[model samples]
Target: MRGLSRGPPAARPPRPPGRNGPAYTPQRMADVSAPEPPKPPPTLPDAEIAALREAGRAWEKAPGRSSAGPEVAPGLDVAETRGRPGEHYVRIVRSQTQGFEPVAPGWLEATPRAIAPDTDFGRIRRRLRTALLGSPLSIHRVLHERLDKVRALPVLSSDALSSVAYATEQIVLILAVAGTAAISADLLPIMGVIALLIIIVCLSYRQTIKAYPQGGGSYIVAKDNLGPVAGLIAGSALMTDYILTVAVSVASGYDQIQSVFPAAVHYRVAACITVVVLIAVANLRGLRQAGNIFAAPTYLFIGAIILTVTVNLFRLITGSIHPTGTSIHIPMTESFTDLGGMVLVLLFLKAFSSGCSALTGIEAISDGILAFKVPEWRNARTTLTIMGTLCVVMFCGITIGTEVL
Candidate 1:
């Protein structure tokens, strides 16, 4: 067997060297390289440049999104991408995007969107109607169900009742200033006028309760029958009246309580306001709860006055009664006069008007008619009747008692 030779092949000879490295210069190649740097990112065409400007303006005015992405603008529906990573490129949407279309030049003004109509009336009406008259029971059943709650009704009813106390105090104060001699016989007729006004206001409010069982009271009545301005006036007046009711009622209550406990007299205004806030909170718990809380005091007050009046009337009739503190003999002032002049008449009218403050709370029932359980209007009317009867008895007894004793 012959062994083959294992040997390296011969290396080629080195050619002549150029400046840096050995290289053979072959036949010269034709010059093939082109001359410009990649043309400055194909300049956006004129039409496209105009489109980009318009799109930029549209984007400025349009709704915004939080992140970077193509977005529709108000005038330009289609958005174009402007660049790629590390190189500038204009990215435009293909012609097929839905709702995308070209806008004519100068067509950039945006129309304001139309406002939507409110649909809250149906909901409000449903709520109010449910509150006012939706229950199925009869008036008697409703009243019976709420009988326990009748106590707090006095907090509402007692405003007028308590005015008796205020009237007496005011009259005494007036007499103190003008002198006992200035206290005239005309006070009798003035008292009568005041009584009549109370009755009138009470009855008028009863009608209001029956008509507008919704809670706005005078405001509701005036608005439904008259107009918004009238309603506004009524609302303002009612608000003022409620505030005065608290001031006057609590003030009078403070005076009565203070007569017995002198220490509380100095804080009368704050005490009155406190009672008003308490009453508002109790009423907020529900109408029934307030009625229940107030009813007993009201009845007790009425009964106490009635018994006192009856006993006094009996004493007067039997000729055994004398006025309290009468032996002190208040001295008459120089202002005292018997002349039946216009000034005297005006004074009488003013006094009567002031006394008529008793009628302020007559509107409460009207304001709270919807709070009745069922047959709301009828129950409200019944409540009104009870209130009226009690008012008449209280007013007459107080006036008569004042005159006699």
Candidate 2:
């Protein structure tokens, strides 16, 4: 049969008026073309169709599909259009099955289309996505590989650990407001207390990891043991904590940069935004890239802080340093203070609460156990332990350094 062109057919002369004002001649119109018969759908080999149909039967019988039935039709994949007029390119279908000799998922992509894929917008979209995020990965390529303890420490803990960059700064800033005397007298004790708090939190999480090997946190614990409302509250609190971490980290980082080049102080907002964007883009590239990119800074910060503290400790032990004196002089902000015992405690507690915000990012590894490699839970727990140990050391050292140096 001839194909009907998408363009209009040949023009016809107008019908002439008759005695009845119009003609009604069905028989005369027989010369005109009739609508074409519908083409039967293309099919696969009987054996292949039978296997697929049988395989899809359970899926077809599932609740949502019950009304429409299996998408497979009369032993045809429907998607397969070979042996029909539209068939052109070769079709390569990988058999879907489990067990040994697993099929590779590449040369495995296909999408049923009325037009060719290369000519479709899908090409442009895929290309753009690839340009932005590297090559596309097959769904099968997702990993369960675990991180070793050293690598895991930074990969899973960078966010929480970044707080070390500014936690002490924040504490000192707050304590300085009362007076230089007030800061010198109270800063060490408050910081030490906060460091102790960090250790306790880390130990508590260790217990939590062991107790809930499946990775239950405050939300799950609250839900399971304390009911849904408590779980919701915990989740909301966590969200708030994360938001504050992002904001405070950026703000404090801005202050640090400002210290080095005070002129950049005005650009703080823009710089912070750029950093956040870069972080988001890195994370979007996947966890592997993120770990590679972020792990260095975390360790560098730890190494620098630890090294500086060790020097101070050596000096203190050798009687070459006085703990009462400040190391690098920090210009004091103008402030007044005539506080007594209880008011001082309140001020210190408030500062500690702000510094404790560093703990916010610790939940990343706990919440993401499945992202770890083989023996997922065990590796995740090990990572958590290492991170906790690092956090303890860093917190204690920073406090001590600030106190003595």
Candidate 3:
């Protein structure tokens, strides 16, 4: 291998004086080039512009005519028609870009007419509903629709207050099974216990209102404090109570009706359903409306109860009314005293449970605190207190009235 020393490599070409690769001219480009002045929007040629004007004038003269005019621009349907008196309107029905076309000099722009709902029945239904329930209120109107305490007391307290009507009857029915002796012996004590319970429950819920102003009742409180499961259980229990309350109220109401109009007993089921539906419809109309619907009767009933109780008390004080001498003959085998302590205790418990129905709607105020006017929690608390006091008075009065009258 002959070493042909190709002469030492020619000296490497020097990089131009800066760093390695290319020499830096260091010419600074402008960081942001000035934005090109916006191009003037394209305009129609004078011929086309003049034709459009002429066509607009022609359309104004014969506004009723429809035509496929001479093609000026592709997909431009030019028609001459009256729109607003002085201004030109153009409606581009079709375009390649599928974009809004500029209003031409003299054409009318037609707006599509509104399509109605599919069924006449729908309109009929809506009209009928409005006639029945009144027009629906908007969200902004919710505050206006809120209840004051006067209205709220009847609306929310109806269930509780109405319970007083039947509560005494229920207690008496249970006691009557054990005879008048058991009734005379047991009614006062049971009434006292129920009255105390009402106070405790009412006070508890007032605190609940204070604590949870947003107003979820037991469900919200339980969920936040205990857990979701507990809240669900509480909610379920409330729902069950509501259902039973409705059922019991309707049945009891119909019973009274039947007593008044004996023929109504033949239509008991129909009558009960009608009452339930009426109540549900009233409530659906909005709480304020329901309050109005119920207010008169509720107050009347309250007045009657109060008057009856007052008169009874007065008569008793004056010694004008003596205790009802109605007596139930008990068998020697089942004498009142022979009824064991266990039997008496159970009977009292049953009577107490029946009377506790008076307390059923107590939580309604707490649950619906948001429905109250401003200072919802405070109004709610005050309403709860008032409701409780009224209930206590009414319950005790009714119980005593039952005994003496």
TM-scores, one per candidate: 0.58, 0.68, 0.70
lDDT of 1: 0.65
Question: What is the full ranking by TM-score, best candidate first?
Answer: 3, 2, 1
Per-residue CA lDDT of model 1 for 108-184, tens digit only, reads 32211111123688567656754643433444445654422254257456776666656754554554444454454
TM-score of 3: 0.70
Determine the backbone clash count of candidate 3.
Answer: 2
Model 2, CA-based lDDT: 0.70
Clashing pairs in 3: 59-80, 90-104
lDDT of 2 at 276: 87
Model 2 weakest lDDT span, ten residues long: 94-103
lDDT of 2 by residue, 1-405 (tens): 378557877799887889876665787566565978999875788899888889898677777554645553222222344676777855554333111122343323322232224565888886787677766444555552335556667767887788876777777777765555666787777766776776777677767766777776778878988899999999999888888788887887788779899899788888999998888887777767777777788788888877877888888888897655434454543332343566667777877786776576777777777667767677877787777667767776777777665
How does residue 82 of candidate 2 score in lDDT?
A: 65
Best prediction by lDDT: 3
TM-score of 2: 0.68
Reference-based lDDT, each prediction:
0.65, 0.70, 0.82
